[model samples]
Target: MLTRHFLALLFLLAFAPPGTCGPVKILMLGTSLTQGYGLPPGVEIPALLQAKLKAAGVDSKVINAGVSGDTSTDAASRLDWSLADHPDAAIVEVGSNDALRGIPPAETERSISTILAKLEAQHVPTLLLGMKAPRNLGSAYVRSFDAIYPRLAKRYGTMLYPFLLEGVVLNPKLNQADGMHPNPAGAKIIAEHIFPYAKALVRKARVRRTAK
Candidate 1:
């Protein structure tokens, strides 16, 4: 019986899909910021993150699922499709478009809540990246919108990066001509700030993968 079991294990290992026993897949689900917007292909946050991980000796595949102009509702609607990749973990950076479009904060909250719930159901470790509404929005609106991320993070027990554009939001050097999406330099800053949190998610993924 021991000999047969050992042989079975060997066979499974031999035929396992590439990367199955190696890097974990991390899905970056967000908007144009995550997609790189007008930035060049290799300068996007996902690509920068992949490079960061490699440099740090962490093996992982960062999948970019960002879509320009996608609101929180849009993200919620396509989450099932995103989950089809069976990501070991996720980093959610949505809601900016909702704020920009003046969508109700409650609606944004609901959509993001649904996203967190779905990810939790799948046992995928998640990192929620918060977005502050434009200050031009009334203080009340800003308060409500800003509160969504921490509240959802607490509720879902997920890691929370307070702001996706932290340290890169207003500076002209960091922003593109549109002053919305980050420039390559801005993207690099984002990747650096997000690296530690993402690394934590990778660790959690590994633990969960091992348990299974």
Candidate 2:
């Protein structure tokens, strides 16, 4: 058994590509929803995603950099700190607060673009999660805000999950009392929806593990 274990280590050392670190750190940058808001511990979006990924056989540590009430601009301002972990990949989920606060879509676009640029420069794979503007925000505002994610994704050549809240938004059972943030049950669904895109990010992050 000792010799077998030693051989395994030797094999890995011989085959593993030279890189700063392995593809195991996954950072999630977002707001209250990812922070769990009113939900209990270990039930937040990032946490649930981590669990899901583990179940899928992708062992990763998800860094939940979610700050309640954070807007896209706010998240952008802290991008450097968030990247300090040197994560192999990142999930960009801010902008919901910006939409709720009526921040200009162009401003949100610029902030998110900056974040994507920084991540690209660092060679960290990123998955941008989209959010739709409130109905009361009017058609024009809705159109502008709703379009930012795809535009930024195209510009940055990053993966985009069209709508983060997809099947959970506005559903009473899936949301907390506030109806904005998702409940634990809702978070599971969201994680499932984003899993495919996240898997792509993981695959990209793992490339460094084998590439010279």
Candidate 3:
């Protein structure tokens, strides 16, 4: 009888569903930054974020859906396909490429808005990582570009990280040789900065999932 009970427990622990024993599933959506361009796949922000969340005692899985050079338009188009993987939550971090390519802030906003709407429709919670343009973009472009994230986060009721590259962008040592992407150290900084916010998003999503 004891042996049978132990075997049953082992099976339950091994094959239990997500809510039972394993971590929550979170989909991270973005561009090269999220994809860890110029760096190994596991060194990206999403993986580091997962590590941080685990450290914080929240069991969670962060799926990296970042594609190199993906613009807001690209992300919007791929939203459905990405969500088909059945992530419990999502973090959106596009628009940098759009800003870099000078793709018109209005178009970027529209794309992000569309993406958020689709995620919302699927009842997937989300976190938005906003991006800012270089001062060279001029005041008009800056205002338009910077407003897209907050506007969408508010409209969709999602958590927003004002600047995805907050502490890592300006640091030369943190950035890669190209000065566009972050090295592993820089990715760690980003993970640390975004960890709490991501944890909260995950916890909330878990609660909602449980309620349902």
TM-score of each: 0.92, 0.92, 0.90
Q: Looking at candidate 2, what is the lDDT of residue 174?
A: 95
Stretches of model 3 off by over 4 angstroms after superposition: 1-21
The C-alpha local distance difference test score for the whole of candidate 3 amounts to 0.89
Tell me the deviation in Å of residue 173 in model 1: 0.8
What local lDDT score does residue 116 receive in model 2, on the 0 to 100 scale? 95
- lDDT for each residue of candidate 2 in 1-212, tens digit (9 for 90 to 100): 99999999989878766563443798999898788898889988888888888898887888999999998888999989988887888999989999889999999998999889999998888899999999999999999999999998998888999999999999999998888988888988998998888778888888854563
Q: Name the lDDT value of residue 110 in candidate 3.
A: 90
Candidate 2: list runs displaced more than 4 Å: 1-23
Residue 97's lDDT in candidate 3: 97
Q: What ranking of all candidate models by TM-score puts the best one first?
A: 1, 2, 3
How does each model score on lDDT?
0.94, 0.88, 0.89
- lDDT by residue for model 3 (14-93), tens: 87555544578899999999998988767889999988888878888999999999999999999889888888889999
Pairwise lDDT winner, candidates 1 and 3:
1
Models ranked on lDDT: 1, 3, 2
